[model samples]
Target: MVEIKEKGEFRYIDEGEGDVMVLLHGLFGALSNWEGVIKNFSSGHRVIIPMLPIYTMPLKKAGMDGLADFVERFVETMKLDNMILVGNSLGGHVGLIYTLKNESKVSRLVLTGSSGLFENSMGGSFPKRGSYEYIQERVEYTFYKPETATKELVDEVFETTKSIPKCLRIVAIAKSAQRHNMAKDITNIQIPTLLIWGLNDTITPPLVAHEFHRLIPNSKMRFIDKCCHAPMMEHPEKFNRILENWLENEAHKAA
Candidate 1:
């Protein structure tokens, strides 16, 4: 298990040491979501995962902009610069907003199964509270392979939804994502972006990836076969290889 640190108002995992690489997770995302990424990249990169204040944020400030604001504060507090941001699902949406607002700080961006364009999130609704089997079914729907939704992962999401306040926060954020469309603002991105999408992703779908590539100039995309929403988890080796090669090529070009 990754050790989560609490300092001031932040709780996150800080590991390795090199150029900074920040990892952001989506709604219902847990530390385990990025376990493969942390292990593979931590050897040569400083990996930081800030536990997004999804459950704790005041319901009024629980939207996309609010989460980006939190990231800004976290970045400032950490005194980080020239960051390489890797985000998945809802985290990708927040990263996009942050990149647009703070372009200089971000040297590169990686998005997978992002939600800013279009997503099939069951009408942007969470499962019925206290229904374990229903929650399991919903979680399984995210992946092409039903077994990808492990018992632990399902239980984690289950426990999270058990709280009424967290449920409210999740609903508000989902609605905010639906309302805040980035089609107009994404064209403003000025840095190199890498989009790694799951070919079988039910949430964002392949068309969404194509749309992102079409909108963002200087962006490249790679699709992993049979992969669903969370490629990093479903196909960690393939995901890592794509990311590693992309990062290396980008660095060489920068040099």
Candidate 2:
């Protein structure tokens, strides 16, 4: 549904026109993660989703700072402005760090199932690497419905986890995110923010969303019932509606 364009070292999907909206995926995320947002908003917004180098980044630089730095370079290289950053899970953490460092460039922020404040991350219970059943269970844990954890989705995660090197990088990035909390710095965010969370998110959970809403001064919160971590995938329609309404309201507020 979306075409990924590569320029230099960055691989991204750029579609439509008008104000720019950058979509950042989570730790084990793929282009499919933001598929709904791209198709829904590309008509009136320039949607951009960068393929983050989670498993490919150098081991030494495989951390939150590394991901945030990559985003900085991508923004500078693309010359993006008046940006609305939409991030999910770890992506949200990177967005928070990005906005904190370059708040002047970001006009608004949307975070769903983000993991800056707190997360379970299995408490270091690394996925049973070669176990398909284990990986399937973990993937299903992300959604309210078990069927939402489609066979293809489970297979993708299983394949990724099966790799030893990839597992190392994943652990490194996950640990860094866990260690780096955003409590003190989130208060510094001055731009308008939106928190879209799954009411039943297990990893970040609903309390995390409450904490985010409580900490960030200019922010709004919306919860999707019977949804888990990735609402965009499980309930694209509802997710897009909440996002579209917020964006429209933001436009009106600006006008």
Candidate 3:
């Protein structure tokens, strides 16, 4: 069963037991983005998916640093220690920043199609409102298979951008991302890390993942063919298999 908890403006889902695994979603996403993977892993491990307020709260100012600070506070509030951190896109960037500052509290790190290492390939422009075509175009950019941009997904995203407050928040986060660069410090990350990328990801692309693997002293990189930015959603079974194997290996080493 999934239990919802709130602390100030932050909300998260906590489920299952044993070692904890915290999943963080990217910009314009909530904890629901990881529902499938969360359910799959909850049977064996404690899974916590936090809804980052950067996207949901009506804030006058927001930045990567602020988001990382929120994660730090969340960890402290939950009394989590040596837990696993898995994040995608902006969430991945926040996870990296958080792990760097609180290395002793994290046992491992997993990043997929994450941003922050370099400038975005999608340019710095925010999605335009009142244009479904533009919204569809932005959504399609994240996928290798354009057909995967189903009607339901496109409509949901289109509706999301229609809200003026949400649009402003999105723009704030995007600008923050453009200014944030952690390439110089990635090498300083000493914890075991896993870098997963989709071979066809155009947003961050596979090249960024390669760079992350090279920078992090103790890290492994894996790529999924014909997949795009959201591999855990586009190719969930394969993604889960890879994650399960990695977790099993870590367990064996610990024993």
56-122: candidate 2 lDDT, tens digit per residue? 9999999999999999999999999989999999999999999999999999999999999998785
Tell me the whole-model lDDT of each prediction, alpha carbons only: 0.92, 0.93, 0.84
lDDT of candidate 2 vs native?
A: 0.93
Work out the TM-score per prediction: 0.98, 0.98, 0.93
Supply the global lDDT for candidate 1.
0.92
Clashing residue pairs in candidate 1 (N, C-alpha, C atoms within 3 angstroms) = none
Better of 2 and 3 by TM-score: 2
- Over the stretch 1-255, how does candidate 1's per-residue lDDT look in tens digits? 779998788999998999899999998887789999999999999999999999999899999999999999999999999999999999999999999999999999999999898988743466589999988988998887999999998999899889998899988898898888899999989799999999999899999999999999989999999999999999999999999999999999989
Q: Considering lDDT, which of the candidate structures 2 and 3 is the better prediction for this target?
A: 2
> Can you write out model 3's per-residue Cα lDDT over 195-248, one digit (the tens) per residue?
889999888878999999988998989999999888888888888888888878
Q: Could you give me the TM-score of model 1 versus the true structure?
A: 0.98
Q: Where in model 1 is the C-alpha error above 4 Å?
A: 122-124
Q: 113 in model 2: Cα distance from truth in Å? A: 0.3
- Tell me, what's the RMSD of every candidate? 1.0, 1.0, 1.9
Better of 1 and 2 by lDDT: 2
